[model samples]
Target: MKLIFALITGLVFGTGIAISGMMDPAKVLNFFDLAGTWDPSLAFVMGGALVITFFGYRLAWKRDAPLFGGCFQVPTGTDIDMKLVGGSALFGIGWGIAGFCPGAAIPALGTGRWEVALFLVAVVAGFYVRRLLSPAGSAKAAR
Candidate 1:
């Protein structure tokens, strides 16, 4: 049941991504272009998401646990550490270069684009490299 629910959720998310035109690298890239072919549609999509997430979190907080989990599993970290900053910068750089964040890229894989495949491969490689470089007793190792 949990797996089924997850599959349904993923499909809904992917469909939303496609409907919002987020799967198109050109559309996403245009969102970053301030002086050139700037597209404001991505801003609208993000705003819509923020509104939905705000209400969703409020409703979720009223419940003691999630429907398919024992706990909410929210992140407890609050520090503005170097690792956090660096990771965010790297993510932004990658997004600017490829116009595909990991979430959107996953669904874009169905388009049979070699760029999407390469992006996913790079993402996986990054994860492996990070795991390898992280200290044995660091918070990253706990993952």
Candidate 2:
């Protein structure tokens, strides 16, 4: 049942990405290019998503548990530490250079692009590298 919901959710998300032209690296790059010919379409998509998420979280939290889950797995972290700052900076650098964030890269896979595949491989490698470097119990606790 959880798997079914996951699949459905992924499908909806991928469809939204595709429909929003987010699957195209050019479109995403254009959004980041403030000095050049900038595109604002992605901003509209992000704004719509933000509005939906704001209202959705409000309604979801009202429930004792999620529809298909035991409880909401919300992040407890609130402090802006070195780890958070470093990770954010690294993510921003990668996104700006490649014009493909993790979410965007995943849906771009459907396009059968080799670049997306390489990006995903690098992403997976980064995850493993992080796990290897993280303190034994800290990794589990972080998750």
lDDT of 1: 0.87
lDDT of each: 0.87, 0.86
lDDT of 2 by residue, 4-41 (tens): 99999999999999899787779888998999979989
Q: Which ten residues in a row have the lowest lDDT in candidate 1?
A: 134-143
What is candidate 1's lDDT per residue for 19-85, written digit by digit as tens?
9989898999999999999998999989988999999899989998899878887778889988889
Regions of candidate 1 where Cα sits further than 4 Å from its true position = 137-143
Q: Pick the candidate with the highest TM-score.
A: 1
Q: After superposition, how far is residue 114 of candidate 2 from its true place, in Å?
A: 1.6
The window of 10 residues in a row where model 2 has the poorest summed lDDT is 134-143
For candidate 2, list the clashing residue pairs, or say none: none
The candidate that achieves the highest lDDT relative to the unseen native structure: 1
